[model samples]
Target: GAGVSQSPSNKVTEKGKDVELRCDPISGHTALYWYRQSLGQGLEFLIYFQGNSAPDKSGLPSDRFSAERTGGSVSTLTIQRTQQEDSAVYLCASSREGGAHYEQYFGPGTRLTVT
Candidate 1:
């Protein structure tokens, strides 16, 4: 994809289940980040990967959440044992090699709704 891509724009899952959302970044972007935006909330950083390495993952809410980058261009976020409170818009963004200060282009996110 020319821009960021995310799958299952809407996901309805039961609590205690697992879900995997995918992301495809731009051609040359080496930095990818995941964030969650709860309803009526702002984007909360979850994790970031530079190429195939995840240098920062301090923002994951619990052990149930994890993400990985593959080949520096694609990424996926997995939420295991989903909880009701985990419902939110999972946004994937990418930037050309730069700091968090850099503006990132975002995907249309996977909106997870745990019921």
Candidate 2:
């Protein structure tokens, strides 16, 4: 069985550019999460999707950040007007439905660099 996966493992773009990151969670997993890790900073939760319920976007830093999960399988995180401060490693994880005690399997992550 496949674990979580992301696309465009590395992205380098000029400031103000828009970037889209993708994530594919494991089959049968109904919970997915997105996180960002800035230099010297801890992993920051961005958003989460649980089955067909509404997504939790409270962790998004700003209006420029948004995400969506389709068919409860794949998700996409879009960043509008990218800035140098947005450079970081974006990680995605997924887990089976088991309340708050389930462990999430993490992907390798996509490194974004805004120059």
Candidate 3:
């Protein structure tokens, strides 16, 4: 009955450092999505994974960003060589289905700060 859980809630890192943020989706949800939201910006879709099949890494901003989902329930977002521009709220959402699915619940997000 859990909604979604994200770790840290806030992260302060130095430039060029790497950070890993975690997300736990609701039980029995078959789809998971990762999105990045900057201040006053819209949600940017990073990647999505369903079951054990291939993942959609379409919106990954650069090679410095990557993510993986395990057991179709939990996911990790890794930002390599973090930059000041990379400092933003990393939000995670999940649904029981994808594409046509709406009302995807979101996590509290991990606010990454690069200083």
Each prediction's RMSD over C-alphas, in Å, is: 1.3, 0.9, 0.9
Candidate 1 positional error at 102, Å: 2.3
Candidate 3 lDDT, tens digit per residue, 96-115?
87764466989999999999
List candidate 1 stretches off by more than 4 Å.
none
Write the residue-wise lDDT of candidate 2 on 3-113 in tens digits: 899998999999999999999999999999999999899999999899999998999999999999999999999999999999999999999973568999999999999
lDDT string, candidate 1, 38-92, tens digits: 9899999999888666458999999999888877778889999999999999999
Which ranges in model 2 have alpha carbons more than 4 Å from their true place?
Answer: none
TM value for model 3:
0.95
Order the candidates by lDDT, highest first: 2, 3, 1
Relative to the true structure, candidate 3 has a C-alpha RMSD (angstroms) of 0.9
Task: Using TM-score, give the best candidate's number.
Answer: 2
Q: What TM-score does prediction 2 earn?
A: 0.96
lDDT of 3: 0.91
1 or 3, greater by lDDT: 3
Candidate maximizing lDDT: 2
Per model, how many backbone clashes are there? 0, 0, 0
Compute the lDDT of residue 52 as modeled in candidate 2: 98
Query: Which scores higher on lDDT, 1 or 2?
Result: 2
Which lDDT value does model 3 have at 42? 98
Weakest ten-residue segment in model 3 by summed lDDT: 94-103
